[model samples]
Target: MSIYGYESLTGRTAVVTGAASGMGEATARRLAAHGVRVALLARRAERLDALAGKIAADGGQALAVTADVTDAASVRAAAERVRDAYGPADLVVNSAGVMLPNPVDAGRTDEWARMIDTNLGGALHVIDAFRADLLAAAAEGRPADLVNVSSIGAHVVFPNYAVYGATKAALTQLSASLRTEFGPRGVRVSNVEPGLTDTELGSHIDNAELSQALDGMFQAFGQALTADDIADLIAYTTSRPRHVNLRQLVVLPTVQA
Candidate 1:
């Protein structure tokens, strides 16, 4: 995507979870390029620091924060750091998620729990941490936004994605509910559901059968969407006029039917 005419997005502070790589990393770079102050949050301190350094070198303001969104305490601490460096973040993106596929017969309860903890619980933790700031921004008549990164798995019932998809489904519903409650307050809540994006997200799969199936299915779709594509979509959603809210966006590859 070309440089965005982000007149409305410039000079805003944004906190992005999972900013170490993939969608989070892409989103951070895109926002920083558009002259927004971006805070990178993830468990990988070294990776976050590297990305932050790159952004700074490119003349963009950024903060690298080592945080685990699954843990409320960690998220809260990260929020404190962001507030100190960039003030309360008016823009927040929940992109920290795990999609470990485990079939019902596999009985991988651990993976299921992991998905719930990170995919759903993690989003909640971040939202709970920064929700007050969002509300405050809206109260101040400032533009505020919360973007949740979901997956097409939420809409389609894939064989092994049952557990992983469930968490994403919950996230989509949460975003919808938040928009309904917060829209009147001027806080735009949006859910971005991307289909078959090319990212490291596939590396977490533990199910061999499921992995092969997904691989073949994706191969059928000539070209998979890239992280930059989704990042652009997210930036566009957040850059819209405060009065305009793209509450739910389902972005899919043309061949992803």
Candidate 2:
């Protein structure tokens, strides 16, 4: 098939967690433009609603679902809602995550737990909630895709990012294993690892020193990859032919080592 043919995603339904902002929002918009029905799942109802409105205005179908990925019940409920509204999702994007930066000795146990809950545990919940549906779609000879958003920290560590990196590393491995196990069943899983993107993800860091350091790093790395960059990669992956599974994609600015 021609490369251009892979850009069209019409008649497909996608559920994007963290669809309220940043990469999640961008992915929703991109997929919607290609004629995909999108279910926007996020904790921020207002943001999701606004995004859904925008997508609708652009002549796309979208559903705004208020959900907290860290909560298993909420994730399952969101999946049910999506299935009810749009049938089985052809694509599932696990983009909900949290990042908290601090030294291990900072006594910030709460922040660490929050990061772990949202990043690793939350992704697991979303994947598990929708696994059956995805596999079912695959069984029917349809293309089913699962995209997990990881981070550069998953491959490389940085100061004050121990917990966050650990969570991402876990997510990376989870995606890899899921891909291997499900590939034979006609389900394709991919990991999108982004580096130093401009997003509100860093705002969760309560430590002043760590926050300042991270901000400085971003400033130095100027021209960091935008959410759109990662979103574009996701669109490309999901739009490919049923037999084509782009397993792993790592995106970063040219300046980023």
- CA lDDT of every candidate: 0.91, 0.90
1-257 per-residue lDDT for model 2 (tens digits): 46656544888889999999899999999999988999999999999999999999999999999999999999999989999999989799999988888888987889888989998999999988999988998999988999999999998989878998999999999999998799999999999899989988888777788889889988898788889988889988888888889998888899998
lDDT score at residue 94, model 2, on the 0-100 scale: 91
**Please, what are the lDDT tens digits per residue for candidate 1 over residues 63-156?**
9999998899999999999999989999999999988987778899899889999999999999999999999999998889999999988879
Q: State the displacement of the C-alpha of residue 17, model 2, in Å, after optimal TM-score superposition.
A: 0.5
The parts of candidate 1 lying over 4 Å away from their true place are: 1-4
Among residues 3 or more apart in sequence or in different chains, the pairs in candidate 2 whose N, CA or C atoms overlap within 3 Å are none
What residue runs in model 2 are displaced by over 4 Å at the alpha carbon?
none
TM-score of each: 0.97, 0.97
